[model samples]
Target: MGTDKRHYKEPKTLPDKRNKRPPKRFRRWRLISSSKAVGRFPVLVETIFVEAIIPDLVITQISNGFLHGKIPAAHLPIVDRPHLLDTVVLCIAENPRFTAPITNVTAAVGREAILTCLVEDLGNFKVAWLRVDTQTILTIHNHVITKNHRIGVTHSEHKTWFLHIREIKATDKGWYMCQINTDPMKSQVGYLDVVVPPDILDYATSADIVTREGSNVNLHCKANGFPMPSITWKRETGEMIKLPNGREVANVEGNFLNLTRVSRQQMGPYLCIASNGVPPSVSKRIMLVIHFPPMVWIKNQLVGAYEGQQVTLECHLEAFPKSINYWINERGEMISQSNGRYEPLQKSHNYKTYMKLKIEHVSQSDYGKYKCIAKNALGETDGTIQLFAIPKPSKLLNGIDNDLQDQAGSLLQDKNYVNTASAASRKFICTNFLLVLSALHRLQ
Candidate 1:
């Protein structure tokens, strides 16, 4: 045995494969294939999170971190940790707690909004902030994906994730989410309620409206604010509005007010009010103006006035823009203001006007057609009246027989008449009158 042991050379310790010179490619392959850390990169986390797989790739990722202990858990696949899952029923008992709750946040326009999500034992996990309404991702851990420059994000000690939104807008009011990357991913929702007073948009809403009568009136109103303000129209004068079809209303609901066949009755200041239960309800006053041409009417179109007597003519007119109202003769000449002999008077009440023409001593010249004229920049119109003379009565005649006898004797005395009346023709009329007078005396 001593002699055999002397021959044994310590089994010439086999060359250590690790220390031996190997092919570069084989060494590189071994280095890559053997490392659990490197192998971890190829596993798709989304698939593991969505579907079940052997070894629970998420657990494996947590067990073996990818980038050698960088604080950023991004390098490690986000997966449901077994401990949190194991604590499910017990979680109620322990309530893997939140350091601070995700609470309701209120912010004004052009201001900053901060939503905080803080938790304890949030180990080896990620927090994501999302908008509940749109399901929009606002923040993920330390990253913010919102394209708006006003959006930002921050985190503290891997336990708190904050979503900072700058220059908030009216549309930014809604629910938000704080999510933890875990199996059955833990999530908490927070509401971000934005508040803003109402504001009117130019060019979109209505201004002062100038339209003609018998035309369609389109009044549009637009507004912007948080909580989505509604628009309503009301008359500033507190009067009811009459629709085209004779419907009367005090307040109309909608952004657009359509009144067909508008009339002067529809003219006034209309208030467009917008309110969303926010502070300071706002309103805009738009004037609805109506315009039309002048018109004239003569109540007494014809008149019979005795000669040398005073008579008056009258007319009524309605016009906007304050018409130039006056009287004209049949010749179409504007009657000039004269002495008491020819006078014209006018009195106005809003759109209505009264006109009168007085002739102190009415004559044949004043008896012809007369006109009342009304004119404005919009248009002109006129109405006419006519006058005539009444003839004077004759005085009662006396001594009718004497006058007849005298007239007959004068005719008989004319030599020309005697020659013209040949034969017995001249006696015919004379004899007939004499016989009629004798017969009347006998009857009496």
Candidate 2:
């Protein structure tokens, strides 16, 4: 078998190597070719077969297998989202700034004025107005613009801010502020000047003048102006008289002149001057008339009465002016004639004039008619009242004796004394005899 194996050939067949899987298509490839002699025994050999070709299988399957794109698992990364930077943006539509001079403004007591501010480049910002002295925020934004009714805010056509004041008063004169909500930056400031006008001269009417002697008189001066007017009084000699309390009497409260307890020397042409800071001072001259009634005269009267009785009498007086005065009459004489018994219930003063008399515990002596006499510088008046006296019980002796007799009889009956006093005395002397008789009686 070994000698024959030298020439014998096997039939040709594909090599087993071809049956093994080929390397990946992306790897290298090789080609194999074979030829055989016709008459000789068929020869067999193993060789590799490969072709260099485009990878068309995968491309063809992908193109023809599906309609469009395919969606993978949901684990995809996000690429687009919005991010927040700053939270809020504040902007002012207008910026307020201004300047005001101190000398130019003039305000009346009951008038109003405005302070103007130029606003520009606001840029979404909020604008507010405030009073500098009071630190009160007057307006906010475009609103007309204050919680206070006295203050108002207005915007001009040219974008200017104006502060309007109503009924301007003395206290309204001050500095004001134009504020914007720009932090770190301070608010703008403006000033206001209020000038008061001089008070006009007040005219004096006949009704405004009062005339009296040894009494108070009031003179009123009527004037009108931005500032209230002050009044002063001067005599023709340009001398100022000492007032009731010795203070300077030239100027009275409001526009008034007062003269207390007028005297003949005080009667003259008096000048009433009215002045306010603003204009020419004005004055008025008038003559003072003093007329009063005569002083009253009182007639010291007497009234008589017994003890334990009420007495009333009248005090007669004659005078120019009628006034009231009462008399305190006791016994037969006027107790008020001297300051010791009769005292003034009220003292006389510059304002009031009256006197009073009072008597308490009226007795029979006070029963006589007493009088209240009213006297004034002009005239006098008298009034009288009658009183009656009542006798005390001691004066009635007969009735007292009768009461004593009845009391003695009542005492005797209470004592049970049926025997006479002489009989009682005799029984005391016969006590031994009575005892013997008592024994005989007992035996019976």
Candidate 3:
């Protein structure tokens, strides 16, 4: 037994292969093939994060749950140390995806606006903010790339990114993009709607309108705003508006309110209202006026005045432009205010006028036909009133001093029936004389 133990010896210990570093090419290949961390372009891993990945690979293993990439390495155990590479590899295992979609943002002008993009498992990929319509890059990662000083970018926990716009303007409204620089360029889009209260363009819109009756008229209302406002035409007095087809509506849609043939019934202040579901809708007041020639009408075509009596003849006139009103005698002479017996007066409201001719001390000369005339830019019109003498009952009774005088006086005192008959006969004689004179003048 002592002789067999003499040749025993300890075997040589072999070096640990896991502790030895592999070749540079072999390490790169291992990182590229074994994990999706490097992806197609390995260089991106070195540039994306705040704590960038080292180009030279650092051997590490997971500890607890968190990567603890920034913590001191001296505190971690050698067997269970953690590094940023583990974080990259974990994030790479699950591709970047939008946790929540970017929502459409409505912002008022001159106000601050923020747009957020939420992502998960972003890994070494980059997040960029872009203006889709303009193809302008606003921000890349944590840096603002646009020259606009109002723009800014912020990131939170490597998951949420924000693009801030200060003092937003009308030009900033459009489609915005939140993009992830992935293999196929992952992207999500949202609209930036800048809401502005309706504003009517005064130059293009209609002002106070003055057109002739039975003429075509167009009222235009132009507005400038986001979402393109809609225009409505309405009466300011809350009256129903009449359309070209004879249909009446409370409110008419479209920018132009076309009236095929305008009339006096349609003259008033029209409201041009503009709205697009925004606050503080705007409106403009446009006055529409209808114009026509002068016209005259008289209630009584024949008037009677006795000797030593006073009488007033009246004429009602309508005209677009203010008309000059006066009274003319049977001899075609305009009645003058200088005369102490004849007084011509006129009162007007809008397009209507009341013309009066007061004849004091109505004698035989005043008992004849008188014309009330109205003159304007459009045309002229006149109305005639026949003035005839009505005999006084006392004078008629005195003229007949016979037996019938008592009967005539009694009848005249009862109801003035005799005077009424005499007035009728005088009016007939005057009318016949005027007709014969008119015929003779026409022949001449």
Candidate 4:
């Protein structure tokens, strides 16, 4: 076709850009802009071009004159008519990124706990919470996906995401992951530790024990809970415990307490304590009773009394499992409570007793060796006391009177006897008075 002089002119060919191709990295992109028509030609007032390439795009992006893009083109085709773009809307989005690490959480059983994940530069990507151990997805963005009602998800300003768990249980303790749906998947993990209080098992623990003296014994304590419970043994009375190795301590640790050659001194209530880091420790009280043969101890092995006087003989005895105590005469016959003449009484405390035999209106027959006996299931024991008679007060006084009379008569018949009181006579009289007092004391 021939060019018209006024309507058309020769088409200008730009030699540098006609067959130009973008670098291999960008070779498949095209640009679009607004333009104004001038006769039959258009002119560009503002250019819309991508400046840089983004290796990956997570989601959609909006542009305002500046744009981040990854296209196969170096530049857009040029136009001659009036082309302009007042506000170009080019969109480039960023992949979700973690600004802060996920924080670990800890809570006791039946309590609430929270794990936080901080993310920045999150475009349209969705964040999810997963159980690392079980590979179970707990929450996606703000929606919970787990069947557990105690689990929930929350977020603050689209940056800080939280995984909420109410009434935490031991089974819920593990590692949890906060993940983003990126090409390679971005994730951070935090641990959730759930603590549990101690609980003692009655069936597996020791109960009240009754053993013989010099025997070996073992006290066992068992408990259940998270983190495992530690067992300790302590005396309820706060007394030191003699370990099997002969070392004494106020408290012992372990599930088994070994006591070697246990004696009466070691008999009491023992406590088994179970404890963990959690609150409200538990304890069990076990009574230990040491049984032994009856033993008798005499305070006074020899006792004396005058006729028609009352006297008491006592014996202290110790035994476990209780003891049968009685008083016996020299003939080995158990003394009976006769017409209120001979009174036998027994006063007992735990494993101990005081045995008394009171002889009222004591006669010559009552003056003999008497025995106190204690018997128990283990063995029997006895203690003896010799009860001797003393002269009556009236007879002793008469003898003293006769002896004084003879001494005075002999002094008066002495040829050298002085009518006036002499030093020798006064001395003898004082000596005689002292002798009479001593005799009266012995009679009483």
At residue 22, give the lDDT of candidate 3.
Answer: 35
Residue-wise lDDT of candidate 2 within 1-444, one digit each (tens)? Answer: 012333333424433442344335412212111121111221121122332112211110112322122222111111121121111111111223333322235666567888776666554556677878888778876775556678887776535777788888778888887776754443677777665654544344324343566878776666655566676667656656557775755444456566688764565567666677756667677667554443433222322233532232323333222344555443435445464333435444332344444434454334566555555654555555554442232332223346433433332332112122245543442353334334435544
lDDT of 4 by residue, 182-213 (tens): 75688999999999999999999999999999
Candidate 4, after superposition: displacement of residue 242 in Å? Answer: 2.5
Order candidates by lDDT, high to low.
4, 3, 1, 2
Candidate achieving the largest TM-score: 4
Task: Point to the candidate with the largest lDDT.
Answer: 4
How does each model score on TM-score?
A: 0.42, 0.31, 0.55, 0.62
User: Which candidate would rank higher by lDDT, 2 or 4?
Assistant: 4
User: What lDDT does model 2 reach?
Assistant: 0.47
Q: Which pairs of residues have clashing backbones in candidate 3?
A: none
Backbone atom clashes (below 3 Å) for every candidate: 1, 42, 0, 17
Candidate 4, after superposition: displacement of residue 115 in Å? 1.4
Query: Each model's C-alpha lDDT?
Result: 0.65, 0.47, 0.72, 0.73
